[model samples]
Target: MATRDTHNLRSVLAVRGFRRLLGVRLSSQLADGLFQAALAGSVLFNPDRQTSAMAIAAGSALLVTPYSLIGPFVGVFLDRWSRRQLVVFTNLLRAALVLPAAALINGGGKGVAFVVVAFAIIGLNRFLLAGLSAAVPHVVEDRRLVTANSLSGTLGSICFSAGLGIAVLLINVLVSAGDSGYAVMALVAPIGYVASALLAWRSFRVDELGPDHVTAPKRAPMHSAIGDVVRGMGDGLAHLASKRGAAYTMAAKAGFRALFGVLTLAMLLLYRNYFVTDDDVHDSITGLAFVVVAGTLGVMVAALVTPPVTRRIGGWRWVAGLIAGIAIALPLTVSSFTQPLLVVAVFCVNIAAQGTKIVVDTSIQHECDDDYRGRVFAVNDTTYNLSYVLGLFAAALTLPADGHSPTAVFIVAAGFALIAGWYAVVAGRWARRVGDDIAQPDPVPTPVG
Candidate 1:
């Protein structure tokens, strides 16, 4: 029985449904994280750090194209299948896709194909991601969403960081002990996939959204194919255009992306006078922040707390203000480090700004319908890549040569960050025009059976 008495998150977490959801999340989150690390590590840990980072950035940037093309259709896929099943199968498929790369470690001519295979895996995996992201809220009661996001965020951070650190260990162990150690570790992909798939398959049972179960199935004639395609395209497009929530979310996302572009550059060695490759700077204490202790911890704090903060503030507007404050602080943060204590203060401000921004940004993105939200998210992802590239290129070219000492790079970028914050604030205001207004509920009612 649903408990009216379950008023708090603690109560909600204690319930069987959320516990089941958490189990399923735990099973899959680690693998999903490992997948990302493999991709980023392939690029980041290359013999040449900067060159590899730029190359990977460029190469992976292309993945966004398919996501844009396939996004609208993915939502349709979400509606048609069982959410639980999709979650499991996607992980399983990831395992399968990566296994070949792992198995043929020393095979002739295959070394070159590893990157290509990884790319393909990435593309196909989006289908799973699209479905799983759409299904999260469906699996939990509304009030417990903060807890869900918090737990998921923490899991994601640990999973990604650990995968990066451990993958190396696994690779080393395999190379020394087994001929196919490389290939063997590749099995991690599939192992995690299959395990998560099992969890998904067994943990939840739900209905697929087809007519046969509810009424009767009717076959469409082959002649109707063109009409069907046209109808699908139209529906997808209409769904996006009509969604005030999604639109506002994207607008806010765009601003965040823009500001994030500037802020990230600010954190670089070129922008920060403190050594660009400061081990202390990069490795924060937060196990969840991955490398940055403060950053990792800050992110976890935001993840666990942002939802309630949002609830208390009442809307995206307050969040926009916080982001704006961060943007304004970005350039100033560099100058704030005149002394040792100031350096610590500078870092804390950056962390707080980044953490709060991310928590708010992700929540808004996922707050809409499943189908078109995929397309919207794809667009958001695409924009994020482009923005990152643009900022990096600009930094490399235009940033001052004086190790973050001159205000030029920070100044220029900070201006943009402020603009982004203003843009987000505007979008928040307009979000009301759409439906993301904290003051208003979802504009369109979800479909009822």
Candidate 2:
């Protein structure tokens, strides 16, 4: 009964600024989905591209490493600048970048030029996302944050998947499976970003989505800006360290992401190489697409289930149990690598990962001071991306080319179990110290009129 009442997306969407914010989130993520799909189709699944586990791992690292490197510094600006302006500028920048990115892909450019341009686009995306997250709390009632997050995050993901599906369809229809099709998909991304930017600029007032304090830093010279970012990041880290719940939540989410990375690489290699015959590349791509769809369904289910489940179990225990559940289920399901078992495993893992993400997001919002929320979220992004890269690296070193390594799977499972146990213990002690404050409602921010 409680779950049914809490499941209403309409209630959250009814909030004034929240609807516009959701539009911005959905639009940006839709572009991200399309951009990523174009890259995947052109690079990973392209017939001309020779893919191996090592190559895939290298590509994954290149894509994510920039986020880890730039996230902290970007968080500084998210705190210091007007978030509304940042969103508008970043989206416009991404729109401009996509044009050249599409040209390069269309013109058969694939090595250094491709990586550098794509990296810049993705890095800018990270900044935009951090700003959006920090801005969300400003738009809604505090008591509804979990529901708002679940709706926004899950719906954003659905839009992303929808974007990917559309890209796939365009690829199939426009140019018949080659660089041209992928290029067409890339062209679609910029429109979403541009639209999102326009929405943000029109919907939000200057400094309305805030730094929590009225004072802005004096406009620094270009050289001083860099120094300020460095100092601000240091201060952000120190501030995060002071918050026990937020720190622990970040660590727990990072561990789950690392596990996710390992399984993602493993499954990529497995479907692309092992499950299908050498001449059946199309069939392999189809199989992987099915897995992606199943994973999307899992994400949707997690969105529906997480809010009420977290309320019943407490956020920390809920995350811990979800992780522990995955730790136990992974090895048992994936050891044989049957098609049905693999699908089930993918579904379950995605559910756990998405649920954990929602709880952590809300916990961070609740616990972290608004002044430092951007940095804390930035650090959270950095940790998850770095851990994922580490997982990919580990998989590259350990998994066979065919990706048929039960031992490697078991190792990841064991890691998850260990992290889950440690997080549970730590969260328990912290909860006692704070007197189970996770259950307490955050002080509601004044609703944006």
Among all candidates shown, the one with the greatest lDDT? 2
Q: Give the per-residue Cα lDDT of candidate 1 at 130.
A: 51
TM, every model: 0.71, 0.94
CA displacement after TM-score superposition, residue 231 of candidate 1 (Å): 4.2
Per-residue lDDT of 317-424 in model 1, one digit per residue for the tens? Answer: 545555555555545545653333334433444444444444433553345455444444444444554555555545545544323534553564465466556656
What lDDT score is found at residue 440 in candidate 2? 39
TM-score result, candidate 2: 0.94
Q: Which ten residues in a row have the lowest lDDT in candidate 2?
A: 1-10
> lDDT (0-100) at residue 347 of candidate 2?
89
User: lDDT tens string, model 2, 1-449?
Assistant: 46444544567878879999999989999999999888877777777667777787788789789778888888887787889888999999999998989898887747798988888888888778778888888997666777888888888888988887777677656664567778888988999999999999999887888877635668779998788788989999999888888789789888888878888888988887889768555677678767878889989999988877666667888888989999999988999999889998988998888888888888888888888999888998899889988888888888888788988889889998998999999987897888764453435689997
Residue 394 shift from truth in candidate 1, angstroms: 5.0
